[model samples]
Every structure is written in C-alpha cells, then in structure tokens.
Target: MKNHIVTAFRLTIVMLAVVGIYLLIVYGGSKILPTKGNAEIITQNGQKFYANIGQEFKSEKYFHGRPSSVNYNAAGSGGSNKGPSNQEYLEIVQKRIDTLKMEHPGMENTKVPVELVTASGSGLDPDISEEGALYQVKKIAEVRHLSEEKLKELIKNQAEKPFLGILGPSKVNVLKLNIALDQLK
Candidate 1:
C-alpha cells in the first residue's frame, strides 16, 4: 500500500510539472512572437483581435493575404484543412488562378507560385514566395502608380533569407509589402 501511494504521488508530481511547463511554454511563446491582428485593417469598423494572427482579410489597394479560418463565427484561428489532392482544393486553386489572371492578365501561369493559391496549413501564411510577390508586382505597381522595377526591388528586399546560409525557401511578408506599397506614394 505504501509503495502504491508513493508511485501515485510521483505520477501526480510528474503530471503537474508537465502541465506547468506546457502553460509556461505556451504563454511565453505567445508573448515572444509577432502576431497579426485586425489592426492591419481587414474591416471597415476597425475592429481588432489581440494576438489573432492571420484571421482577417483586407482590400486590393493593399496586397491581400492568404485565406484564414477562425471559428468562422467566434473567430478562432484555423486553416482550410484540405489536403493537396482534394478535388475541392483543386477547384479553389483554379478559382484563385482565374482571379489572379483577372487582376494581372500578363502574369504567366508558370510565374505564379503554388503558395499564392493553395491555403496554407494555418490559412494564415503571412508570407508568400518571392515569385508570388513578383507575379503581383505589375498590378500593384499600376494600382499604386509606382514603377514596376521599383516594386520588384522592394519585393526582393522584403524577402526573408532562408537561414544563415541555407534552409527554407525565401519568403516575402505580404503585410509588409502592402504597407510599403501604401507608403510608396
């Protein structure tokens, strides 16, 4: 009986430690990261969600971001949850392609990256590939009345490096690019 009691006590202690550590990590990480909120200007009312990154949509004058999902009604962070081979996924991709073509008629299908259309795991991928940025450059330039070459330069500079030397592919923060676009004039 004593042995069993000791074992139970040890297990309880371990479980408590795990819970405490998990909360610590979650709270600490949340505070440390830069999360997007409605402050980025998704709605006309200027409603803001604290630490709810990638949960809103904005306008064309500003570059748009990837699709995101929250509780849909309550606004919890989520993604499309569709796999690459899903037919629904395929249809959405096609729709996005058509839309992009409509927006920038000159951007060849080959130039547009897959990341631009497909929903990311979080549906909140704040960054797109440099190619995606370039694909939209002409349209953004025309809209902002800025030079295409200058827009390209800005996009290139905004791309984040993979690592110190090499790792992940280069990515451009859509939010940052749109902010710069607004500031360009």
Candidate 2:
C-alpha cells in the first residue's frame, strides 16, 4: 500500500509538470500572433465588428455565413446539438434549402454547399469553404450588376489558404468579401 501511494504521488507531479509546460508554450505562441490570439476586430463606418465572429447577413447584396444555432451570439457559441437523423433538424435544413432556392433562381438543381445550410460546430464561424462562396457568385453578381468573373477573381484573391498547405481546407472570410464587394463600385 505504501509503494502504491508513492507511485501515484510521483505520477501526479509528472502530470502537473507536463501540463504547466504546455500552458507556457501556448502562452508564448499567442504572444507571436498578430492579435496575440485575441479577437480580430475591424472598424467600419463608425461601427466596430469582431472579424473573427460571425454576423448575420440577410441582405440580398451580401454573402451569408453558416446557419447560427445561437443566432450569432458570441456568448452562446455552440452547435444545434441535433443529429442529422433528428426530424426537427432535418426540417430546419430543408427550410433553409427552400429559401436558398427561392432567393437564387440560378442555383436551380444545383447541390447547395453543406456549409451554407448547416450550422458549424462553433455556430460563430465567420468563414465559409471556397466552394461555398463560389456557389453564391452568380446570385450576387446578378443582384449587384457585376460580372461573375470579377466576383470569382475577388474570391480567389481573398481566399485563405490551408494552414501549412495541408492542415485544413481553403475558406473565404464573408465579412472581408462583403467589404470588398461594397468597394467594387
């Protein structure tokens, strides 16, 4: 019994040391990031917006982000907590799909990008997959009276590449894209 107690005590010390070192490393890493790992904020037209957090954009002139389970409230960031098989979740997704179809007639018969209809694991996702942005190009171009090619080019320029070229998929920041769109005219 004494030997077991000593072994457990030693293990506890080692575990504590490991966790401490990890915390120190993480803190050091944050010190080197642009925002010091804090929220990236942007000021436009006297209004401050947290660029890292998703905002609702229902205007036809703007690009929309993922569905927000918490209505884009930063304090309540979370998924819907419903499985794909849940009837309520399915109904919500179906309604979103129907809305998209009605809004973008050009998207007829096209498979809507999954990200556009689904709430992200963190409902506050401010970015969308590259393909998701492309899917909306036609509708935006038609509404804004801009060429589709120009919109596509903007998307290409604004796309954030995958981390280290292989860690994640490419995505477009919707806020940045919409800001640029406003400046295009």
List TM-score per model, in order. Answer: 0.71, 0.89
For model 1, give the 10-residue run with minimal summed lDDT: 36-45
- What C-alpha lDDT, on a 0 to 100 scale, does residue 140 get in candidate 1? 70
Cα lDDT of model 2 by residue, 80-109, tens digit:
899999999999999999998898887878
Candidate closest to the true structure, highest TM-score: 2
57 in model 1: Cα distance from truth in Å? 5.8
lDDT of 1 by residue, 1-185 (tens): 99999999999999999999999888776664333112333432375432224434345556665655442233444577777799987888888888878878677555567776766765556777888778777777777778889988888877788754486888777766765666665
Give the number of the best model, judged by lDDT: 2
Residue 82 shift from truth in candidate 2, angstroms? 0.9
Error of 2 at 13 (Å): 2.6
